[model samples]
Target chain A: MALDIPSPAALQLTASPAAVSAALTTTQVRVTSSFRGARIVLYGAVFDPSTTPSDVVVIVRGPDLPVRIARKTKVAGVWVNSRPVVFRGAPGFYMTASTRPLADIAGFGTLRRLGAGIDHLAINAPLEQHTETRYGVRDVVVSRLGADYLDWRRAVVRLKENAGLYDADDKGVTFVDKDLFKAEIDLPTEAPTGRYQAEIILFQDGQPVSRKVRSLTVEKAGIERTLYLFAHRSPWLYGLVSMALALGAGWAASLAFRRN
Target chain B: MDLYLPIAEVSVNAPLLVALGALVGFISGLFGIGGGFLMTPVLVLMGIPPAVAVASMANHVAASSTSSVISYTRKRAVDFRMGGVLAAGGVAGAIVGVEVFRWLRLMGQADLVVALSYLVFLGVIGGLMLVESLQSILRRRSGQPPKPRKDRRPPWLYSLPLKMRFPRSRLYISVIPPVLLGVFVGVLSAVMGVGGGFVLVPAMVYILRMPAGVVVGTSLFQIIITTSLTGVLQAGRNQTVDIVLATLLLVGGVLGAQLGAKASSRFRAEELRALLALIVLLVGLRMGLGLFFTPDEPFILMTGMG
Candidate 1:
């Protein structure tokens, strides 16, 4: 029920993905909005429509968090009290809530909640779920015909695929698969004549799985390159253009207002 | 005063900006556009890097728009058909802004062009705003309601072709002026690093004679569209948009605008214009001074980096 509500505090972002795993149906979700105000620190998370609020693990972890929040107990072979303990913050503590209690291998396996009876929760046998995360550009291959050699405007780049496991589909469907993922970098004609590098990363369950690196080269053209260097090297020319632009823009603005 | 923002580290210093959203909201609550002239320069001085400031301002304006547009819809201050026509022309002009920025950057002359435009255009705008507000103030002091520009076609604009019929402004204007205003703002945005609100808001209030009711909302709609694109592009290109930064500014701006909207009605139209005029003049002065006396340092040579 809470999933439908948009959390203003959530760091929401939207990205254009051209692949099955890349296209996020609901890219913007309430990550969480917990901030300490005056006294109490607010901790919250949205309940997926299918799951009850009690069943979800709303973990709070950082420095000085409680190790245990709840414990399961059985009396007369009839389960009664699910242990709930709130610990006072000491120093560096982190808190995590999980519906799956360890002692059994799979934690809170695949949940197929049936209308109003019971959600079929089995042992975690690789819970069929996937999340698409963004990794920085790892490596880039740039071809520039050396400064004062090749035309600066004609720089081209072929970004080869940086392989990573990405979510295929999660429309409440069975069995999610891996999808091809990559980044497309766009360059403006004004890129500086130099070398630049970027890094790429892969993540699973809020953890880094892999990483890579890449680079690019920016070179200048002939005639203009010489002219550009000459103009910039000579301080006078730079000042000249700066003043000229200031005067021109001033003139244009005046014209806009003066027309009336 | 806790004015320093956390993520951007850019303290919002303008007293007028701190009060503007509240002021505008107040008037928009009462009469309208009482203090619009102040919005642009105030945002600039706050160190929002121009583009995002305008976009954020626009988005904030949308909230105000949400409020007033409802009333304007009731009062019919907004001639729906006319606004649509202007918006259509404006979109065509807006495309030019992106190109102009790219072109200027290609020449490694973006800052130069931007600074120059600010000097030239803002001078005229600031001068006009000051003079007009002063005159209006005098007229009101002399016990006159200062009959608004009842019906006069600004000669130069009226002279152009592609005439348009705007019922609310009650004039048959040339499509050229509005479209040109749109393009001019678009190009200005690239150089100015604005979402075009600084240019367009004044154009609407002073040039087009839009009832104050429609100006903020109409301008905001455009700002939202432009800025949202800008947000995506900035994310794609620079990857410098720290969501934390944007959120901090948004948080401050949203709260500020709410207060500005409430402060609107306490001041008269002339008073608002006077404050606006003062803001523009201050920005103009700052730019003018920088022009004559730029810092004594070997300015880093900006080699073209697309």
Candidate 2:
């Protein structure tokens, strides 16, 4: 059956594919869904729908955004949302959009963008770190930003890395029993104010079957901001203050009991 | 040492503390001894941080003692007048103990000294008590009338001046022994993480020849002084005194103590003494065994005034 699928409407060809991928490295991809082939997914910013691919199929991808991500609709039984999908590798590779849902099942997918599209990767099963069954997967692809888009950088998606976004020692996550396992990471004082994309990939026989792309955040709390106001430039002092507070509170409680 | 339990932070773990407190309180009530004799050592054995264990035990002691003491006082089982004199001495001893603790800490010998002293004291005193009670049983079995000493004080304790009368105990003798014993128990209080009642009660009965009526109250009075000081000192130094931990033990101890006191009334005095002896023997064996054949060094052997 023929369907009037959504595709990019005001499409244009300014720069060649090679030049577009080179110029728009990571954060310089425009969302234009032009359905010419068996269209699968569309990668674009949520702000401009006109740039989003339609006529075939569309799925908003890429995280590292400034605001909230909302749910759009479902293809089958799985929930699809207007969010960022990150593929950790170079940009400028052809991604074929599959017309049919992955596994024709409820909760799994392997999607990619067509021409002028961003790269995509998928995983198998979910993992919960608390349990003993742990899983991990890794895949990278080059994506292209349309010539007219502002900037699209070569988005790198490593299956595992530490995140300082949580103001911990590391970033990203590992799949443990279908749950997420994030190690500690350090957060720089001048880090950007946006959501970073990190996906938990599950592998079966070295190939991804199930996947979950998560948006991580980096922001200062009120108390953290107040402390930063004076010594906002020093991360070392900020860490010291946090340790001091934990220790001080413990000491004060003991003192109060001792007095009574 | 990773010795401290994170339960002090979690609200869900409160029940464990309470249950432990109640069980220990019941045993303490039954045996007529402060649970610290068992608890402090048990916590230490179970790998609790010494500072937290001792401070927490002290808080537990205060709660447990008050639990039983209140009921004993209401029932006219506690003799306040006699308790007052011992408390006077106890206060003085506690002050000296605190000073000694500071001096020992400065010398970097507090841990070893406290532990060693407890090991020696428990070994010697517990052994002596066991021997005496066993001998008494043997004499009874032999069907011989027990040879009794004349009803007169030993010359040294009797000869001292400042002989004062204790109305409740009805004794007129020197106050020196009780005071000295008070001092000794007080020093022990800090070192051992006990309320000092175990030492105070026995010393009163044997050394001072105090009437039974006065024993519990006097020991309780001494405990109040020593433990209160201990609480403050530990908090000031180690900052391990968790109010939440203390509060849980107190609630459980109070309720358990009340129930224990009622249960005590149902048993005869002779039966109670027999049961107390068995408990004393058991605790003494547990401590004594810790001293000799055990590979893991009894930590008590390395503490206070040693």
Q: Which candidate's lDDT is highest?
A: 2
In the range B136-161, model 1's lDDT, one tens digit per residue, is 88988999878667555467877778
lDDT, each prediction: 0.39, 0.46
**Interface RMSD, candidate 1?**
26.2
Per-residue CA lDDT of model 2 for B1-306, tens digit only, reads 011122121122456667777777776666566677667766656445455566666667766666566556655767566666666776676666766766655454554455556656655566566566666666767987765734565678788988888776778888787777767777777666777766777677777777676677667756765676566555554444555456566666655655665577687554455555555556555654432343321111111111
lDDT of 2 by residue, A138-235 (tens): 33221332231122122121111111111111112222222212222222222332333333222222223233333344333443234333232443
Off by over 4 Å in 1: A1-260, B1-76, B144-150, B154-164, B195-198, B205-217, B225-242, B301-306
Error of 2 at B18 (Å): 1.4
Candidates' chain B TM-scores in the order shown: 0.70, 0.79
Task: Tell me the docking grade of candidate 1.
Answer: incorrect
Give one digit per residue, the lDDT tens place, for model 1 in A33-131: 121111111122221223211221211111221211222233344222232222222111112222233112122331122100011211111122223
Which regions of candidate 2 deviate over 4 angstroms? A1-260, B1-12, B102-109, B137-150, B236-238, B265-306
CAPRI-wise, candidate 2 is incorrect
